[model samples]
Structure formats: C-alpha cells, structure tokens
Target: MKINKILNNNAVVVKEDDQEKIVMGAGIAFQKSKNDVISQSKIEKIFVMSEGNKKFQELLKTLPEDVIELAEEIISYAEGFLKVPLSNHIHISLTDHISFAIERLKQGFRIQNKLITEIKTLYAQEFSIGLWAIDLIEKRTGVAIPEDEAAHIALHIHTAKLGASTMENTMKHTTMINEMIGVLEEESGSTVDPEGISHQRMVTHLHFALNRIETGEPFHDMDPDMLELIQTKYEGAFVLSQKMAQFIKDEYEVSFPASEVGYIALHIQRVLERT
Candidate 1:
C-alpha cells in the first residue's frame, strides 16, 4: 500500500494492493503531511474506491451524469432530513444509510429501530434534539410527519459531518417557512376551499416538498412521474409564494420578512431548479 494524496492533516488518499483500489479516508499519519508515506492502521473510512486507476477514471467519467445526479438528490434530502451542513461525503454517507433504512421501512418494520433507540439509550443528552425536530415539524406543518421520518431525520441532523451552524440555519429556515404559510394567507385574505382541494392541501404538499429540499435530496423511493408532478406543482407554489409576498407588501403593507423569503427562495431554487 502507498500514499497517493493527502487530503488534510488527518486524511489521505491511498492505494490498497489487495483490492488494487485507491481510496480516500481519515488517517492517523497526520504529521508526515501531503505526498508522504502513511501507515495502514491510520485510515478511518474508505470514502470512495475503485479497482484500478483506469476504473477510477471511468467511474469519474460519468460522474456529472449519474454519480452527481444521484448525489444531488441525496444532498437535498439530507439538507431537510438532517438540517445540517452536508458535503458530497455527507451525501455519500446518507445514500448508504437511506438505502438500508428505506429497505427496512419497506419490509414492514418501523424506522425508529435499534439505532434510533440507541440514541436515547446511550447519549440521552441529545434526545431532546430529536424530539424538538419532530415537535417543530408538527407545529409548523401540521403534517404529523411519520415517526420514522422524525427518527431518521434526527440522526442525519446530528451526525458529526454536519456542522452546528448548517444544522441550525437549515432548521430555522424549515421551521419559519412552514409557519410562514399562515402569514401568506392572512395577507391574501384568501380562504382555503374545503372541497378536499384547497390552499391547505397546497400547504401540505409544500411541506413535503420543503422536507425534501431542506435535506437537499430527492425522494427516489417515490414514483418518478409522480415526483415530476409534485415538482411542477411546487414550482407553481413557489411562484404563488412570490406573488403572495408581493401582494402582502403591496396591498397589506406587510412583507414576507426578507430573511424568511430568502430561505423560501433557496427552497425554491433547490426544489424547482433543474440540475
């Protein structure tokens, strides 16, 4: 095994002879520095791997089309699900976790399983954070997010890779946006129809949409056509939101707080923009 490139003081790139693979991970050889020999025992996790340099090259070749496409969805979902700063690596971690979690959820088992239970069992101090996320979502969106969604989202938001600032900002934006719907209605003086088709329904769908956007991920588990429809509707909602904001300021002398609108715009850009 030999060192390839050092990513940071505590991380490095290496080629493992057994697999003939080049992998990236956190390493113990922090002192030797970049382009220096690293001990095998120091590596923490293999972030990525390829059988050979050519294979690695090939993998990267379609990255723009496939790898990044998939990763973008993962990032979107993680942004909402975790409410944290996520890099491409966080996207990778979430992709791996969600694949299994979704499979388990599909198998008729609840998602708040042993791992979730362990959070309360082990680190009780942060248990309230999970509860807080669920409470905030429930209070703002009125959707009663499935318990499974709450548990998994809590995990993603609290993971080490997600910075505190990122998590806090995302959470604040999500909470505010969910609650902002009421203000829009108040300003518009429009009442939601009660014929099972109303602004209330739009609000609900927007909640779901915001959930995906906040997490910076796509709901691959959902039907592609249906997802497309939902995306279209959300875009329409975004435009409506902008109009409502303008109307509020113009007619009611009230504005959708600029800070809140900025976050709403981010959600719009992430969910409606074609990547």
Candidate 2:
C-alpha cells in the first residue's frame, strides 16, 4: 500500500483498493513520504473507518501517539476476549476519551462516573475490560485513575460492541431518568434513596425501558384491565408516570406504548412505597 499521508512516525495513511486507510506500527512511517510504499510486515494495525466517520482524522492528528496505542491495545484485548469485531469508530472514540481523561487527571480534574453501579450491573463484560484497561493505563503512565473511569470506558466498549450510538444516549437517558425520579419524589412526598435496592431496580427498569423504546419493543403482556385498576388505586404514581411520559415525549418526540407507561407507573409505585 502506498502512503498517502503520514499521521506520525509510527502511523501513516495508506490507500488499499482505492479506499483510504490509516495503518499503524512501530516506526512504520519513519523516513517515509507520500507515495512511499509501506512494507506489509511493518503494518501492525489498520484502521478502516466508515466514510461518514471522519472525526478520527482530526483525533489522530492531535492525540498523543502512545495514548492512541494504549486504546488499540485495549481494543485488541476486548475483541479477543469478547470474540467480536468492534466498530472502527471505537478507534477514535476510545482514544479521544482516554487521552482527555489522562489530561484531566494531570490537571487535577477528576470526573466521577455517576452511573458506575448501574454500568457494572448492566454491562458486566464491558466493565471488566474497562478495569483491565485502567490497570494497564496506570502501569504504563504511573497515574492513578479512579475506578469510576472503568464504567466510563465500559460504555464506549459496549456501544462499539452493539454497533450503535447508545453511549451518548445512555448518558442522556440516565439524566432523564434522574429527572423523572425527581418528579416522582415531588409527587410522592419522598426522597429517593439512591443506595436502596428499589432505586437500583427502578434505574435498571428505566434503562431497559429506554433500550426497548429504541428497539420499538414495548411490553406486550400487561393486562389492560389491570392497568386501569392500578391507575385508579395508585393515583399518585399513575399521574407521575403520565407526567414522566410527557417529559419523554417532549424530549424524544416519541410516546411510549400504554404497557410501557403502565410498567413505569408500577415502578414508580414501588419506589414511592420503599422511600
């Protein structure tokens, strides 16, 4: 493959089959120039990014080479352990996140992962890989990263594995869920205990509900009559659930099915009782 552009001493952009690809290896592009042919054995990794995903181009230009290599190491380990090829977007996404995180830590700005517990419970495999990455980072840089970073990294891995953009949506959904819980608390005259099992279950339920909404898979087994009975008996929870649904509609421009609303009400009622 002929080098089209040089990313760094260790990496270069090359053309293969008339498509642009960035290839990386130790000193692969050293003493190389455009139109130079790269040795096949010197290429350690090739980044075949989607045409729409051009962020990596800028990301590769600014990020430290070692930080990018660290992300590649972690991605390789994750693919081997999970037995799946992740999206090419992760190459830039994860590298950008890690580099920024390392810089933030150096500047004494520690960002906490608010969804650590939920992340661990919901995405165990991804979270495990994140932990390994954290350890690897510390070993290489001698910088201590908070365990919460594991959860943050896990979101990137999970989104790559799913071949979707749910990582950003997950943060947005969690924020919405927290606001919804605040609405529930205001209506029920109770504060949510974040450490309680009920809170965990409710968060899990809402997470799954959002996932279902994305997949267009609303609950199908709830009885219509039972929903009516609960709406009448649990007036506060039902009203709160409707308000939450309206919030969802306003934010998402989509409405949940009746069963989904009913399930939300049931979860709201349980949270009210526990709190």
Candidate 3:
C-alpha cells in the first residue's frame, strides 16, 4: 500500500487497487521511509485525504488546518451517533459517523408518523440519534439548548427523510418559550406561586416549539424576515421568565447549584434560540 496522503502524525491516506480512502489518525513514517510497508494491522479507518503533500511520511507530523477541521467534524458526528468516544483507530473517526448520520436522517424522514404511537415506535432510533446530535452540538458549541429545541432536532432527525412540509409556527413559539425562560427572576411577582401553571406553560411552549421546528416553513427555508418576529416573541417570553427567575432566585436565596441556573437557561434558550 503506497502512501497517498498524510492526514496527521498518527494518520494517513493510502490506496488499495487504485481506490481512494481516508485513513484516519495513525503511525508516522520518517524521512527516507519510502516504500516501507505499512503494517496491515496499522491501517485503521479510511479518509479521502486528497490534499496530502509529497513525501507523505515526513509530512505526517503537520496536518493541514482544513484536514484537522474535517477530522473534528467527523469525530463529532461519530460521537453523536455512537454515543461514545470513538476508538483511536482512524477507521472509526467522525467522518464515518457524519456519513452514517446524514444517511440515516435522510432515510428516516421519508416515512411520516402523523400518529403519535407510530412515531414512538417506528422512529425511535432516529429520534434518539437526533437527541444525541443535539446534545453533542450543545456541549460542543456551548449554546444552551432547551429540551423543546432538543426535541425538535430529535423529531426532525426522525422525520427528515420524509417529504412533509415543515410548519413555521414551531420555530416562532420555541424561540418565544426560550425567551420566556431566559429572563425569569425571583422578583416582580411574575412567577406563579403554584408552580404548576409555570411548568404547564413551559411545557406547552416547548410542544409548540417542537411542532414548528419540525414542520415550520419559515425556519425550514431560513427566511430572514422571520428573525424580527422570532425576536419579538422571544422578548415577550424573556420578560415573563426574567421576572420568574428573579422570583425563584429571591425565594430560594439559599445557594442553588449553577446547574439549576444552567438548566433553566437551557430551557429558555431552547424555547427562544434557534439552532
């Protein structure tokens, strides 16, 4: 197997029978190491490393910025799909994961589950992958995503293969709900004492957000005009929530873990922020 391209110090691209493949992170070959046979056991995953420099062995140490970026992209996708850290083997890196996830998303969306039960059963894995993808995106991107937004991604991943038209209202309300939670405070008496009403409202907004995201026309097409509408609704929700968060903060002045604040922030962002 002749060295075609070097991906990184521990990875390279090689050819078998003139076929191009991406070989992920792997062993390095130093200068004057040409024609040295790579161990069959050493070859890990395949990559389309078209841009590797000549003297691939010596070039192995320094990876091009784009290649590194590509590797990271693939790893994220793979981690999301496999729900685990990928093996060091280049063969199992993120590129393969991204390919697999996109394929699944395209296939799963084909069959629409208009009925709730069918959705729960037939599309469960797709939904799970969607959830996985969202969580990965959130943790990686540091963008607080609400449960509803997370659910939207899950549902879309479940139904992305389908040809059904997405609804616009979903994005609008989801944004609104997030905005609603973002500004919640312990003061100004915006929060309901019972807690039930607030919870119910939050849930309701979440549902709307999910529905819109899954089927919304505006968001699906990336309409710029919708930004203002989304922002306006989000502000309304934010005002309501700001007061509520303050209320809770004051009422529970006892130190609460930052996780609680994060959770609430995520909920709000989910409702208010667009992926």
Candidates in order have lDDT scores of: 0.45, 0.82, 0.42
Question: Which scores better on TM-score, 1 or 3?
Answer: 3
Ranking by lDDT: 2, 1, 3
Clashing pairs in 2: none
TM per candidate comes to 0.25, 0.76, 0.33
Model 3 residue runs over 4 Å out of place are: 28-34, 49-177, 183-208, 211-275
How close is each model in CA RMSD to the real structure? Answer: 17.7, 3.7, 16.5
Model 3 Cα lDDT, one tens digit per residue, 159-246: 2233422324333333343443333422222443213443444455444434443454232232344434444555554444445445
Encode model 1's per-residue lDDT on 1-275: one tens digit a residue: 56675444443456556443334334344566545666667653354453333443343343332322333344444455546555444444433454444445456666543333333332233344445544554554344444545445454545534343354543443344434544454544544332222333444444454455456655435445644554465655445467655654565344453333434444434332321
Question: What's the TM for model 3?
Answer: 0.33
Worst 10 residues of 2 by lDDT: 48-57
Top model number, TM-score: 2
Of 2 and 3, the candidate ranking higher by lDDT: 2
* Reference-based lDDT, residue 125, model 1: 32
Better of 1 and 2 by lDDT: 2
Sliding window of 10 residues with minimal summed lDDT for model 1: 62-71
